[model samples]
Target: MQFKHPEILYALFLLVIPIIVHLFQLRKFQKESFTNVAFLKQITLQTRKSSQIKKWLTLLTRMLLLACLIFAFAQPYTASKNQFNTQPETVIYLDNSYSMEAKGEKGPLLKRAIQELIENLDPEAPISVVTNTTSFSNTNLKSIQNELLQLPYAPNALPFEAALLKSEKLFSNKPNSPKNLVFISDFQEQQKPFSKPLDTSYTLHAVKLKPQVESNVSVDSVAVTGKELGKLKLRVFLKATGPTAGTVPVSVYNNQTLLAKATIDFSETNVTTFTLTENHIPNGKIVIEDAGLPFDNVLYFSLNKPEKTKVLHIHHQDNLDVSYIERLFNNPEFEFSTTFLNNLNYSVIENQQLLILNELTTIPSSLINAIQSFIKRGGYVLMIPNSLANLQTYNAFLEPYNMVMQAGITSEKRVSKISYAHPLYKNVFEKQETNFQYPKVASYYPVKANTSSVALAFEDGKPFLVTQNQLALFTSPLNKTNSNFSEYDLIVPTFYNIAQQSLKTARLYFTIGEENSFDVPVAMQADGVLTLHYNEQTTIPLQQYFNNKVTITTTDIPDVAGFYQVQDKQNPISTVSYNYARAESKLSYQNLENLEQVQVSSAINTAFDTIKSDTKINALWKWFVIFALVFTCIEMLILKYFK
Candidate 1:
């Protein structure tokens, strides 16, 4: 019904000249009378009415022919009803993360999406696919869809908005108009806020995956192994959601050996803390009871023994804050060291894993250079400023990295608005059955942030918790000059977060969960070992390394704040792991209300589902042209031969 170029319709004006010429059309009737006139008069009298009607019909046919020619030149045809042209360049934002595997029809959410995709395809139309990739790639539609169909469903999730924008850019080569985009997913509430805007030029189809409410018992979280030697402590938490299942069975393993078994209840949140009697398990794994949701039933992880952390504490000449902070890392497993502003040994700051700059009234530029280099090489710094800490030195040290501290602001209003989103917050409540909320941002420093900086804590209305690149920083306005330290609860979690973030380095990092056997770059001899000691007794060997990493069963390593030693033992070369936490609480599904209204049903009829076959296309439009030709031909031969 639409025209590709409707403007050609003006060609109808060409018919005016033909009509004018016809008006002037005349024939000189030879006045041959007599006998022939008598016979002609009798014949003309009998057929005069029929002949007049034929003349008008012939004129109308000529006008129709002119109109048909003009219309054909205009290139008129049907446009796509999918908010764009029928031959749209489309990108399908397919949600294939682990979370997409939630049970639906016959299997999971992803299966339904696949089925719907097959049914809804605008036969032969271009379509690209996108999933949960850590970094996006630019690729065309067909190949992307093939890759998606090959991947299995999972429980992992990705940001909704990010994936859409990525898909848009990939299909940008198509004409600006008549583009197509489809988001096939379960519009979970968290994902709803990030939904993309509708594009009329690009037909948007939300092939939503239907959600059904189901109870989920997930391993909400687990805490660091142990703080001291022989403690070998751990806290494993279980969260019961939806309909309670009373008690669930849980088992754990070390390598292939079954270590412990227990029953977990669902009436409330459950926290199970147990110790590892064996000092060297090498690798560890945990298997929870299968509760229909198979993706989270068994968790395989690894751990490392405790190791010493070489710490550098910076302070003013007469400041006593250094001593108290220094006392926390005094255990032999930790080599506690100190320096005062312009006087300390520079080499200590370079080699140490932990750097603590205290109530320094002034900081020399030399330390600033050391701090910058240290962070660049995977060093962790903890800034606990007393009122006396030098604002100028702190600002200068953080300027290049885009973190700044404003001078001389002090108040203890209480820890008001806490940032529960940070890992620091998670670690503090890891052992509690119920998630513990931070009391309040007591009288403390207000933290600020830049683009790369993420707030990990807060006080008043400012950010007290922060991370830049991978470096972690916490600010406190306590006891600066007043010598009155407040908000002591922050001490443990702050240190815990520092240790965890500092020691984070992936054995191998991949954007997608579907991949296996990632390549490791650091060559390990056939039997050489790269060891990571958590405190004293526990040690983790880097089984392999390449491309700046190796394959590590994340849970097998100890996530404590310390220096890791990668030793080939025979050749004895060393490497280390900077802090990064593997588990994120954000993965926990909070909505008990199942997403049940999504269109994961049997294939429904839609404009996109039509397939083009010569038989079918010819049956309609071709018939129109055929009938038009047949009628026109009859009219033409009748006029030509009879006349």
Candidate 2:
């Protein structure tokens, strides 16, 4: 028995004082008065035993009162059994994420959670088991127990919140019954919360998931390129998510035949590349047979033949700086062209995959509007600041779409901290053969602020390389007045990454960090069917959105699959020529740290009915009060009869 207020029992010590008073209440048997009455005085002493008996009776009453008072204060209660049950209906949310695959003392977490539910089930109680799989639904113990044995691992993802909400809604339908929720999962913090369940309404039983101690290696991402029908070049990101680093050999195969192979020097960002020599090989899986983690071992992609996306650069002026950009960007994918702003027509924004804003601070209002429209419609714009740059005017062009560049300078010393996470650094330098500093910008103008912009490069701890919300506007600080402007290393990768992003030929096969939404332009109507021809044979119809300019978002392109060519049959003008720009080359990888945030819902609170029990354990305290009442009535009757 547990006492809610056991300390109050100290008051029982007062019983001693009452006992003393009761003893004193016994009168001397009136022996002297009896002597005055001239007889029976001898018998007075004989009645002394009666006096002692009355004193003892008074003591017994005091003891009873003290016992009653102590019992009231201590408030002892028995642990409730069956809770005077209203037949509880419980919703058990099972955390079935990849992390749940970790083994537990009982068994695999999935089976253990199920077993725990079965053991905890009161025969009178009803329960629903949810695995958080896409097929999650409410099912009774008899109906789902057999199904649990055949539960297949879900491939999509752990949707913690969605599962919880579904549980809550199912429990809500049953009223008056006691509701309770039991959850089993790794309880990753990255998971989002579902409907907030009230504490009074349900009991929360949280089952902790076992920790992950084993090393893991996963494929963080993969990219494919070349415009040909089947000849595919693949770059895969192999991350050794384990505590220590190691190397692994990743091979690329077309069907069962080994096409190309590369030994990846492993790190957190373990990367390897291989080329499928022959073009027109549409479908195949590139497998990393020896990575520690199996989830990322193999990636599936459809390869296209040799193809490159074109980028036309329009510079404000043709000078040494502009010539360097033109030469660095001279490749099959990029058909480089440039003219003075005055010589170029306004419609150039419409024709080019990307436009370079070099040394042009003051843009024509029409050009600014065109650029803004292009940006909203998902066009790529790379802005390089110059000595005579107008920060206010440039910001005006980027302001609407969540971007601004303000820190002005002729130059300040800076260097690109190669973010291997960035596609630019992914496969470029695999193993560090030499301590190549690449190139350093002696001076730069960092973006004064960022809203939708992510600081890709830093200058004196300020953002020098910034990407806009959609990643469409890539701004860099190229203080043209700085002596470093003529260097090749400093300018090449910047143009390469930004230009590649614009061409849309480089298919990003993974989603890690947040990416901005950029325009996917095809001359098509809002409702037109845009086909993505991965190779010569496979064509996938892409969904479109009708905004100011017919634009499409790129968030849906996370999968590694065949090439695509968008086609709008209704509007013949809306057609995009399919091409592959994937550069197949293998390189060692950088060790990228895992994100600390848990990306799945914890499903902490389950849903159940609120059944109020008619009898509570608190009723035990009432027993002592009732005993006092009955004793008081008896004492009153006895006193009246005796008097």
Candidate 3:
């Protein structure tokens, strides 16, 4: 037996007052030997004995009534042998991920779970409710009822193992009592095998909610396979919950206008390709019709018209290598130009995206200063050394940047290895071929550098092509007399990539609830707040601008997937797209056989019943009050009829 308010039990001491009064009353009887002193002696003795019994009975009734009233106020309760003597601290973990949106037998899984929890919860016990993104701790079940009703599906999800560890920490400094952690979730298979062992001190209960329909299809992702003037080839990836194949309708739309539609014959393969004409549209989306779960059914994407790259080649005189470089950048995508060292204009270097120096014997001080300033402002430079290049002049220009040119030249070296993982080679080739011939150099400048990444190495383990920050270095000049590098297969991609990397473009899309950042190129002196505009509304995200680049970082993303424009006041500068995470697409669930170690329940009601049966608290205070009333009635009958 336990008293909820034990301090009130001290009222039982008041029983001493009735005992003293009864004794005083016994002594108050006068020594009356009045009428019938001798004749009434026998009668008096009988009366006194009967009266003494009555007085003692009345006193016992009064004491019993007072004790019962005190116990009633104390709220005494009897705990079952299996129950804890102290009130339990219960933590209920509610899964609010998108997976919980699936329909259950009763209704929505999350809603049904919450309703069952409230129905079976002990009103007197303290409870804590933990959701994927929020926590309500040290409160009663009734206090959080309104919050539970208003809960929405969260974009983020918590793994079962992480949720268990978080629930355990909530009871770290709490008073000694029975502790319990209850989980209500669909128990996705991906969340199996907890990262850490459960604390044995806590009683763990799992209420697994099963969805009525298990089939689900999602538009996983989209990738660009090929691109030309105004046309793009895209491959859409789809995934299904099960192997049962069925056809699905897929469509591409530019805003509300549908561009193309196709019926995808579902099968074991996950990828399907489609050719989409750009038609001058800057943004678009891919949609697939799916039932059950709809969060990942649409994918947002955007297309930016290729910008023209400005290239300026500075040389000592007209050479064949300079013409080769011009041919590489002569396409509509590039603004190519050439100038001699003596005819160079310093102001033109500021607007050029890339500056190429071809076989220069010496670099003047003024030109060197301009090149250094351009590199610092996010410009790229590619240097090709002359066979008889001035080693002192090259060293003086490159030493400050942690690079230098060697004094001698080597003959008969072949380009043997390529760094395929480098960003310059991203999407350049479908796959590397094993029997492709490499370019050979008859005589080349031996290169030396302190800190640089080897992009292309020779068969002799020498650095043929190296890069340091915005600078790219080739050990040998591209003339036919020195090497055939300018005429080989690697020439086109190498030069085109150098120019392509100079333009700073924002990514087309980002995943919600993840760290997303974008870079925007602006003038170093440009100052103003950048804002993101969506649905005719504007919001300012966290940003840092430095060195002509503005980096925007934010996690307060849009709830719906769509295209949003980035602007500085009124001029739209870039487009950004956001989509929901694909983690909850598959409807696979954890196997019941693997969860034998934990207490598992199929329904919320079953879980509630289990908790109730394990923690039994019988309220004895009401019974005590009933006994007090019965005793009072007996005393009243004795006083009225016996008299």
Candidate 4:
């Protein structure tokens, strides 16, 4: 047992006052005469024994009360044997992640945690404090208390296992002392489990904070539908974390103007599609009002005006499929042009988004080289076969890309199946019909190539339409003389989708803290440098330029999730959007069962008690105060009734 204020114990000498008063009262009393000798003698005999017993008991209680009061005022406590020899080395892992913004009993969970830490920590002991992004080592509690109070919520989070390992490393070379690690966090369930067994040398403590509310809703992702020219549609994916079911108000905005608003019943559906009639919106966002966790309630997205896709059709002079090809590429979204293989311009090949070879008898050496260079620079090509063409020239042209044209033409095949899930067919149809008509080809060459996917296959298990990287090939010509493919309903969509997929545009959205890279089609010429703009601020990101293509990488420009634009000086080249990570939207937490080798406490005060218990220092001041009051009450009762 130890007294906090041991010098105050000198007041124990005041116990002499009670002893002196008892001694004075015990001095020789004057003899009193009794009215009757027999009655006086009996009264004297009975009263004397009872009076002596009551007086001694009263004196003992008074002396014990004085001692208890003194002990209570001195603030006595018992310390473990090890505690007296050295101070404990404590490391506190405080979770400052955005999830810690949850409200607790007193205030924000983080504020309450800081208050509890300040009140319970040993002032004299040197401590270490670690947050998600920063740490301070070998500092006293008083020195870092202000910094703790001012610590802001961090955008990133650290797992419990990593924090524990960091704490272990911090104490590796420290002087020998009783070691302790206290982890104060909400213990979100997304944290990965410990990979290996923990070191047993240091004692571990956990303080888990509980959120005031249990329900949360978040925007999971956004996807664009249909690349048409008029109105654009966005599909927003939302998820509810708890069992609550109700209507949530969702709104879409372009820049600062409100475009559309709707209320969705999340109990029935998790996806909502919104269409914006306003064309050419460079920046936009969708917001939902959710008070439980507002960080993930808003999703940002960007849209570029549909650019005209430049298509170059290279074909033979007598090709019969030119009319069908022209009709497919005549939409307002495409810049369609045609040229014979003999008169093809190599300079124009670099400017085209797609190239179509319509039943050509032979591929020129220079044309094949230009086609290879075009595909390498993110261009698409579609080829149609000529049954009686020069197979040697075609195979020689394709051999460098691991592709070949077989010599024989088969006349007994029809397209048996279609890969409806391929990106080439995305958003082409509302729904796939089971009994759709299949296109039949009278004659086609069996292709031999290492292709990425077979878009359409023949009944004999041969590929009808095969795609190798950026190149798409057909085994049969589209002319009416060889097959009915030119007249089939599938030909229109097949050619239209290829033209649509060739346009280069920014991605729909990116997640914050994830690496983002964009490929701009504009060349870096003269003194032109790429700059990104968010709100009113401008920043230049890391950029590399080659062959009229500028690749930009953003390192530290965006600190928050929102819509941003990349430009060369004043010309806006592309727009992109960023959204916060959705991992924290999952409010599931870890219980004691999830953490195996650590002591856990839900309350901060309880955690302090656990630490004290580990050191064998049990506080006795409260017990002494209670005992002092009880003894005083007993002495008063004896004095009042016994008299």
Better of 1 and 4 by lDDT: 4
Give the C-alpha lDDT of model 1. 0.54
Task: Give the winner by TM-score: 1 or 4.
Answer: 4
- RMSD in angstroms, all models? 9.5, 10.8, 7.4, 11.4
Candidate 2 at residue 384, lDDT? 68
Relative to the unseen true structure, what is the C-alpha lDDT of residue 351 in candidate 2, on a scale of 0 to 100? Answer: 62
Tens digit of per-residue lDDT, candidate 1, span 1-643 = 6555668888888888767866676743344467668788776665766665676677666776656666666655553332223344556677776556667765677766666666666445455667654222444435445655676643345566666677666655545435545566665546445434564344454555554645666655555457456656656777655675788877767657987777776665487776766554434555577454555555444454444556677766674644456556666546677766667888766566667776566667877787877876556777765565667777787777687777645554433455555556763554433334444423454444665445443433566656776466556643434423333555656665565455443331112223322112244445544555544644653344322234443342443323344444434333333222222212333332343322222222242342221112111334335545655776696598644
Output the worst ten-in-a-row residue range by lDDT, candidate 1.
610-619
Candidates sorted on TM-score, descending: 3, 4, 1, 2
**TM-score per candidate:** 0.59, 0.55, 0.72, 0.66
lDDT of 4 by residue, 256-349 (tens): 8999888879778878888878766667888898876767888888777555778999988663657888888878778899998778778999
**Better model by TM-score, 3 or 4?**
3
The ten-residue window of minimal lDDT in model 3 covers 191-200
